[model samples]
Target: MISVGVDVGNKFTKAVVLKDGQVISKSIVLSGFDQKQSANEAYDQAIKEAGISKNDVNYVLATGAGKKEVDFANDVVSEVGAGARGAVYFFPSGRTIIDVGAEDGRASKCDQNGKIVDFAVNEKCAAGAGSFSESMARALEVPLEEIGPLALQSNNVIYMNAQCTVFAESEVVSLIHAKTSKADISKAVHDAIAARIISMARRVGVEKDLVMIGGVGNNVGFLKALGDGLEIEVLVPDKPEYVCAIGAALIAAERN
Candidate 1:
């Protein structure tokens, strides 16, 4: 039996195909202006990779901020639950999960089975979120892929104290005008975001084996800062961003 999971995130659309509880294939594509098209593209690519047909997929579970746009989905799961479930599926021992996505940031506490017991989320602003970081990369005239590594090279970073993305833009611009190094500025951005996520984790009683999930989890620089703040080793999945879609597919299998 095959199950499909689609995650329509703000920045991208991801899809995964599962056989039993294992992910056979997955794809991620930029969301573009047309979210529906993006979701379809992701689904198509995943099916191609899995060597399966649309009819072969027993169920399609949707998740993420824009799951409703995926017309083909059988059901939609909460992003919070999806992230927590995904993290635990990828790292079964993970007690805490910090998920930073394009639209928002979230923290969740889960049991041994990866079932979420509590969570917190910030949807009002982009501060400390993926979109904010992407915007910073644009303002700094650097690629998103380079921001993390360059951030690690900074000697000292000037803190971005504000949580508002608009205000942070003005602050970053002022820093640039003052000739602040890009490395330091990038480090500061990661630190600023880590602070926000840490608060959410602490409130939920962050435990050992904390894992960082979501697309933001791939940022090695951000993970370093988060580790320092939490004073613990952060467990990251081999394919961090794909975890949600993978989890959704696994959950879909249960229904089938």
Candidate 2:
């Protein structure tokens, strides 16, 4: 059976094609103003890349914040549910799934079968999510991709006191004016975000085989900070951001 999964996120759209429980193709694109349009484009791109006709797809499952916008989807799955299913695909032993998206973060507890048992989310604030780092990177006048390596060079421990994104941006600016090194400020930003996410995850009870899947999972600095905060080695899939889409596709395949 062949299936497709579309993850319509706040800032991006991801799609994956799954055939017989294996991923055949995946695509990612900026969400832009029209989420539905972006989702369709991502799906089309995935099918094209897989060298298959759209008519060959058995089912289409949608997940993420904008899942409802995917008008063509046969079914919808919650982000946490998708994350649990997706993380387990990469690490069969994964018991804790951490997902940090553009504007929110979620932690899901999963059983051996990748079914969600419990979950927690930090959706009301951006301080614990990917946006925090993007905003902080802007304040430091550094490219988002460069922040990771720069943060790894930090030699001093600097703590950020703000928990609100607006306040955090102000704090970052102040640090810039105070002659603080960019590396130290960057590390502080990642550490602060990591601390908030870790606290949220602990409430749901973190377990062994911790796995992280999201756009922020690709950030080396953030990953290091999160792993250190949890005092465990965090596992991230090769395509961390596409995990949700992969899970949705798997669900579609199962439904078939």
Candidate 3:
């Protein structure tokens, strides 16, 4: 069966094409003012990469913050549901799933079949999400892609007390004024976000075989901090940002 999944997130839109439950092609694009347009653009890019036509697809599913904006989707799934399903698809033993997106962070505990048992969300603030890192990186005058590696180079244990992104940015500025090294500030930013995410995960009862999915999953610094905070290794699948789209495609295949 050929299925397609489109995830319209806060910062980006992703699409994945699958054949018989295996990923064939995927695309990611910035989510502009028009979410529907971005979704279609991503889907078209994926279909083109797969060398397939829209007519050949069996089903199209949508998931993410702007999922409802995907008017072309045949069905829709919640972000938590898609995250759990995708995580389990990558690691069958994944019972604890953590997804840190651009605007929010979520932790879900699921059964063997990817059915959610309990979940917790840090939705009120961006301090625990990818945008926080971007803001901090900007404050540190470092490139966004370089922040993770920079953080990894530091061994200092500097703590950030701000829970709000605005305050966090100010705190970063203060640290700079204090003559703190950029590496230490970078590490502190990642550590603070990881700590908040871990606290939320604990509310959902974190278990073995923990999986992290989302754009932030690609951040090596955040990954290390998260694993250290939880005292467990965090598993991240290839193209972690596209996990939700893959899950939606899988769901489309299963539903049909």
Model 2 ranges off by over 4 Å? none
Quantify all predictions' global Cα lDDT against the true fold.
0.87, 0.92, 0.94
Distance from true location, Cα of 27 in model 3, Å: 0.6
How many clashes would you count in candidate 3? 0
Clashing residue pairs found in predicted model 3: none
RMSD of each: 1.4, 0.9, 0.8
Top-down lDDT ranking: 3, 2, 1
lDDT of 3 by residue, 211-240 (tens): 999999999999999999999989999889
Separate clash counts for every candidate: 0, 0, 0
lDDT of 1 by residue, 74-165 (tens): 99988877777788887888988888888788888888877888999988888868888888888888999999898899859577867788
- Residue 69's lDDT within candidate 2 is 95
Q: Which one is best on lDDT?
A: 3
Give the higher-lDDT candidate: 2 or 3.
3
- On residues 1-256, what C-alpha lDDT tens digit does candidate 2 reach at each position? 9999999998889999999999999999999989989999998899999999999999999998899999989999999988889999899999999999998899989998789999998878889999999999999999999897888898578989898989999999999999999999999999999999999999999999999999999899999899988999999999799999998998888888
Measured with C-alpha atoms, the lDDT of residue 130 in candidate 2 is: 93
Residue 66 lDDT in candidate 3: 94
